[model samples]
Target: MEAFADWLASSELGQYLLCREQAFFDRAVADAFGFRAVQLGLTEYDFLACNRIPWHGYAGPEASADVVCDAAFLPFDSRSLDLLVLPHALDFTSQPHQVLREAERVLMPEGRLVLTGFNPLSLWGSCRLLRGRRDAPWGGNFFAPTRIRDWMTLLQLEPTATAFMAYSPPFSRGDWLSRWQFMDNLGERGWSLLAGVYGIEAVKRQRGMRLIMPAWKPVKAGSGLAVAGGNERHPVKQSVQDEISHG
Candidate 1:
């Protein structure tokens, strides 16, 4: 743990933790779940995992939990949470699947899970492992995004989105400008080739499927609006618009 902390203290991603979406999601999870948000990691004081806790002493009306506990085996009940964030915890966890299964067990039907990890296909992953660097926690089993997608499928979690980040650590203080220039030119999607980490968002895929019947609902015969192929109403519900607006 101490070694990990030392490495992080020197890594550029550590510095960016505050400005990144990781920080935002950490707080968002807490807000979405009230007192149910929890973080699991190899150990406490991991900046990547710990820095996301909110400033307030807890959350909710009478209860609050900006962040709580460091137990690797979480103590939450089944379907007890709305959001689960891995916080790049998979890269270092010895029992990654076990942790993920626990998370699945605790999440509700439509719950969302986000995972962040090092990308083995990326330049950073290759150099970190093959180069045999001793300074940082590089290279154990750097995983590709596809393998993670498979795992999510097996667990009935559908990957809704995938994105890469950290496109290459700013190893030297003097090279900061160059790194930013490169990233700015390439943008995040193209930058994944060099990114230090990548994040994937997955949601539990509902087992049963729904079939929409365009003709099921009755429509006024010969209405001015064209039904096109079916009898379904042409004017989509305004509530959908409102919902999209809210979402």
Candidate 2:
């Protein structure tokens, strides 16, 4: 599978898809301020192109990666990473949930997580299905966007933004792809779920967050006025005096 991934990057169709996906990555993470940013997989795309982080790293089973490590067991320290990008890593891995757990562990509180994957509900997904999962990229699993978001929420990560891209069908020729580029606008406007890929950005929020509300309990009012004491029996004070005198 790793060999397939490396080879896919050299393919014409893969290049086109990479350019589109990388553009989305660039736009999504351009404003994400952080010191350490890591691209977990798909080294071909250079997911950190638009970021100005102090330190950046790449990790995968591929030798080209900065660190070849398991996605379910990253080498970084707990709460050390500021930004993490997983480009088509989850669906390709054996234990996707465990990989997410590792990502959450390494990310600091309020750190950003950018995940990209093939949407199972898209046209590309259907094509991959009809074509069978025997060849290079199509061989991997295609997870749904909503299910992916739910998984992030379970880890106490809040999704800040999501973008769907690569709306046109996977085409090899540059001219053919350009003609179908109008689909990108359409997908962004109305047919969002049909986009081939979805990029989701979530922040790793710490547990035990509390909402700040006014420090007061629900107040109950007496019949009209409060009770006062002694001979303070003015008209307005009579109600108070009555209650106090009765007591």
Candidate 3:
């Protein structure tokens, strides 16, 4: 699994999928604004090339990466990153929920998170199951889109859009792949949830309510009329009572 990046970089099927994903990712994250952006897991693809972020880093497991670390244990301060892109990381990780929680921890409030995964309800997934081969991605665990959506919701990540890509079945030949390209249109409209791969964009949200307090002071009774001596049994009132008694 360590050389999986190199294997994928040179595979014919991988090349085809990369071409399809490049455009989809560019559109999904090109206009995103951020000071720093990260591409995790798939190191060969620069999916954030069109993004406007100043700093972009790529990381992979047991591979040459700008920052070599685990996705579940990101080495960044809390709320430091503006954007994050996980290129099929969750689908290929042992702990998908932990990776998501880490991403949410590093992202600033309202920061955008873009990620992709292999859809288990698609032809490519069926092929993976039939092959029963131990490879980088095929060996990885594929997840359903709805399941991922539920995970995102639990992490307080608000899903903005979910796009289906690579509608064509996994084919090595250009002619056969081109023939099946019509599925892109039909799959996008009707069979969207059954796409081979899916990319979801979500925004991190902080849910704490703001606290407001009003100023308060001790209240004294009869303070306003204390100077007038209206009903305090004062010496002046006592002298008036004595004169009334004498009369």
Candidate 4:
């Protein structure tokens, strides 16, 4: 966990999300929705979640809001959010299913959820094994889009688009310059099949749980006013009505 956090903190990708200029997900999402706020995984995110650049100015420098809690159990009213951005959360999370379900619950119907993660079958995943490390987090369960689509299906989220990126990790060490150049020049164009990561965009599904208040329901008076015939009055439920009316 520590090694992964260190790499994540120092990596170019981290800088992009934190600073907004380098992170592809941040830039793409900001462009797509122009959201007024976003929910970040601060509780389980360790360092990356805590130190985030607010996309909107409404949450002032110390505002600290838009709901901060566990990703697996998000503290949000269902179907009230405009967008949910999952930044490589599945790579490390133990309860990915629960986390995804919570994300699906919060997102508004037709809202977009943008997810990013490393690719398992890419060159990057292979490189991790060559270093004599059997259990590193670099490619920890890096899933292909098809596998992810299965997970998304369980949550009822529909995939809208998918994109691959980071054909080459930005050359860092002086020694890796040759490999980077070779990969960029020849590998990417011809045989560089391993992309660093993949991103996915999915639309939130509208479950049948939407609550509908009937037009004829009597409005209770203010200040704890008791209804005279509350027990006798039955509101018409849309779901039941739809089922009965359809037949």
Best by TM-score: 2
lDDT of all predictions = 0.58, 0.84, 0.82, 0.58
lDDT of 2 by residue, 1-247 (tens): 4755664567776776777788988998898887899999877558898898989999888777999898889999999999999988887888999999999999999999998888889888988988998876787778898988999999988888888888998776778888999998888898987898888999999977688988798755444443345333323356655766699
The sequence of per-residue lDDT tens digits that candidate 3 reaches over residues 1-247 is 3544555677766766778788888998888897988888777668888898899988767555788898889988999988999888887678899999999999999999999888988998998898885875677678898899899999999999998888888876778888888988899788975588889999998998888888788665532323244555333445566665699
**Candidate 1 residue spans exceeding 4 A from truth:** 16-35, 42-72, 133-135, 169-180, 189-191, 208-247
Candidate 1 vs. true structure, TM-score: 0.63
lDDT-better candidate, 1 vs 2: 2
lDDT per residue, candidate 4, 77-183, as tens digits?
Answer: 88766767666667656777887888788777787787777776776666665654444445455767778888998888999877666555434453564456445
TM-scores of the models, in the order given: 0.63, 0.81, 0.80, 0.61
TM-score of 3: 0.80
Q: Rate residue 125 of model 4 by lDDT.
A: 67
Off by over 4 Å in 3: 1-4, 210-247
Cand. 1 Cα-lDDT: 0.58
Query: What value does the lDDT take at residue 200 in candidate 1?
Result: 80
Error of 4 at 77 (Å): 1.3
RMSD of 1: 14.0
